[model samples]
Target: MSRELSTRANNVERLPSIPDNDTNLIFGEASVRYSKGRLLGFVTDEYIRAVRSQRKSIDGFFKALRELNSNDAKSLLYMKNSLDDNSHKNIAFDNDDYKNLLIEYLKDHPDPLQEYNDLIYYKIKNNLPEKYLDWFKKDLRCSLFLAFLVKKSIENDVYKGRDELLEEVVDYLRYDIEIFNSDYSQNLPHYRWDIMKSGERKTADILYIKSYYLKNRLDCDKNISWVKPTDNEQINWMYNYLDDKDRKYIILKGMFFPQTINEKYELILASLDVLSNVESPDIGTKDKKGFSLRNYTLYSMKKAWDGRKQYEANNFLNENSSVKVTKENQPKLKKLMKFSGFTANKVINHSIEQLYDELIVDKKND
Candidate 1:
């Protein structure tokens, strides 16, 4: 996942999967099906943003879809059309069969894994003339893209403009991302199927899928607390030791001011040491389900940092240019306090007579 998250921005346009022939790599990755699902998710997200305004324009849609699919199925994502882009394309509509095909495919196959696998199986079963399952993938790409786009757009409350609503019914992805719901997805490597079955496991691809998919997961909401730190070291820390999804919470709920990478690293290391130390308050601590250990540690760091000024104020006295209480005189003051015991009071009154002698000598000299 660290490797995957680190290289995402460059690969947004070029999703990579290992050659199916490479069993070691396949077994070394996330579920191949899941990796493919992430790729399909990306493609659809882009296409959705592009042609969301049209439903009846199946020809134009497929042309656009084919254009996307044709481009190595890993098309470059030029994110066009924000809330401001108004130059909607005028594409001709017809091809009921094409429209029906997409609608039916989307209705039947929920994820790209199924969409991709079904065609692959079909190509194998029938001994189809197609040499590469690649052709079938191209055909289904439109449907897959549309399916996810329709769902995502709805989930984000993004409908087409006033001229945007239409007959095409969108099945929105649930607000609570279903991926995290899976036991295996939440806990990786340990739960991955290949590792359990065989010693040499494959899960790099899964990490990539999860990493890439997470980038666009909350595209719809601006108010969400997903703090995506682009720093490679930070991302590596998250993917390696912490859950990527908990980033928002573990990072002081995005409340912490930015620190240099070295500072963050040091703080995290310090916090971890404190948590593990038997004498520390964090020794037996357990954060609530939603609140993470990192979150607790980060707040503790803040708390400690905040209390420092107060600590110095109470423990150290500064007399600001009056007769300075040097280390030499401090012991004298303490001895005076001890000798006087507050009853005689005379012991306290004399600055041991030294200061009076010095002042009188100075006056006589003057």
Candidate 2:
């Protein structure tokens, strides 16, 4: 996969941001509650580790904690479940020891979020919780999760709005689809079957991006093939070629533009159902161990793209000389053909419509 495609494929794990200043916008109650567990999981590693080091029976620790407050205990477990398995397990295993240790830690560090990081502490201590929840009904855990998400976003430096994320998905989809449109790619030798315990697997990059298209674009379902679809047969072929989960993944990404913030968080929460904490992949390994939610979350928390549009194709063309092709301008036409993804042979053989389609000019211009 191209660097661009890989970046976009991993974008589903991005955390939404809150304003650094006093802004009166509500993120929507559903969205905040939806994202609370994930945000808490990302920040509670240190606390989990400290508790687990002292415990041997994880279930016992939970049972004792449940005795304190079953509802909060359930929320905390949900938060723990959202974390990479190792951290939560090591933090608390044995019942009495882990329970006492956690309670002691909470007593000493009454505000775990504050102790988790300086930035999170600052945001929460300063009264930003009022932005997400009713000031009077503030839940410490939920507020901390929101703060932690913001802190993580600040640390990662990658924040985007619905439109920005959607545009990125479209750009990446275009690049991936066009790059492999050659006879060599059509040959099965260029592709390999995934080794699996069960079920089917396809090319990693294609599988990820195609899912984004199917779910996000109404027109996308009409043309599912690697090549631009010109007929129903081609479209149907690609659609049927996809696994059912591939279709589900499209709905999963929401084209990166969800209708509501709550809807957006709902998508992230959905991942927990399919992925297990035990399966967390080390971000350093890039082999066929396959895409890990761990890697996705880590990578997402670290990337940011500002002013992405400045690098679009039209800008590249504008920066180059603006020249129109006419029957009298053979020299200019010849010069144009020398550009990448173009050549004299291709220009002469393909009609204007075909050339535009192949170059993705129509999609990009839009």
Candidate 3:
């Protein structure tokens, strides 16, 4: 069995690698351009300087106290007595300066805040949580501060007038979506399974496999094969495909599992679903019969389970209560549920159901 699995895995040769330069050409000139260059660079430098200055100030303050001479001891005591007053005065002055600088920057770059605000609004329009957007707004305080604020608000469920916000955001995202969707071959491979999981490729890179290879993979296994359908067969399959959650798992996996930013993939998923009927497996099928039928292999199932568990654990840590779960948590959970064992589909389905229930309660309260 082990040899058989090994041979099967080995037989499945990796798709041929495309040269990085070749893959990047698909993005055209716009892809080559840096969208966040100036803003990102300025923010990074400012953050680094602030951190260094803070460390230096703390070190100097401690050194000054430690090296106080006998004659300066009295002066030190006097300084200590006036410390709160001096500190308050300094704080007020600093705050005023900071505010002035912020205002000047905003005036010079009048549209950054607006651009960010619009960008965030677009995300909300696409079903991102209001609370998350609001949280981003509060946490990322800078030129794009308002945008981050909106993000945090959405994420944390603090953003009100959601319908209005979403409408505005949709209008904003439309332009970018148009550019992204215009070239399918250029964009599709970046979102593919192997490239995303490999981590060798950069996010900005335009990755793709030969269409022929993709079709071959789909048809290799019967159980996992993409099913082709006639016009009559399409409607029944389409209804089941969209309406049945189990059938929709592939869509979910393709859209959400690989991408860090859900919004972009969500857009792509919507575009793909519209352009090609995934219900007709023939859309991506290589051979006449599609792929060869094979049962869900243990290896694939385990891989799926592990991936889902990691996703859930990270999500739970990020959004839920402050109770910290260490690296050992998942292992602990597995131990606690040892009797059940690890089955990726079962674990993911169960976890999602539990999370869905909690979300329902949370929504009701809201």
Candidate 1 RMSD to the correct structure: 23.3
Strongest candidate by lDDT: 2
**lDDT ranking of the models:** 2, 1, 3
Encode model 3's per-residue lDDT on 1-366: one tens digit a residue.
011111111111132323333312222233212123211111122322322333211122122223323322322222222332442222212323433433343334323223222322332232222222232222211102112212322233222232333432332222222332233333232222243322223212212222222332322244322322322232233333443554342222211222222332222223222222122333222343331121122123335546755775665555435434356765665454443443433554677788988898778988
lDDT of 1: 0.30
Clashing pairs counted in every model = 8, 12, 43
**After superposing candidate 3, which stretches have Cα over 4 Å from the reference?**
1-240, 250-366
**Candidate 2: tens digits of C-alpha lDDT, residues 100-147:** 554454344433322323322322232112122232123222222222
Candidate 1 C-alpha lDDT tens digits along 103-174? 344334323223333333332232211122222122221112222323333343333321122212211111
* Candidates 2 and 3 compared by lDDT, better number: 2
Question: All models: lDDT?
Answer: 0.30, 0.31, 0.30
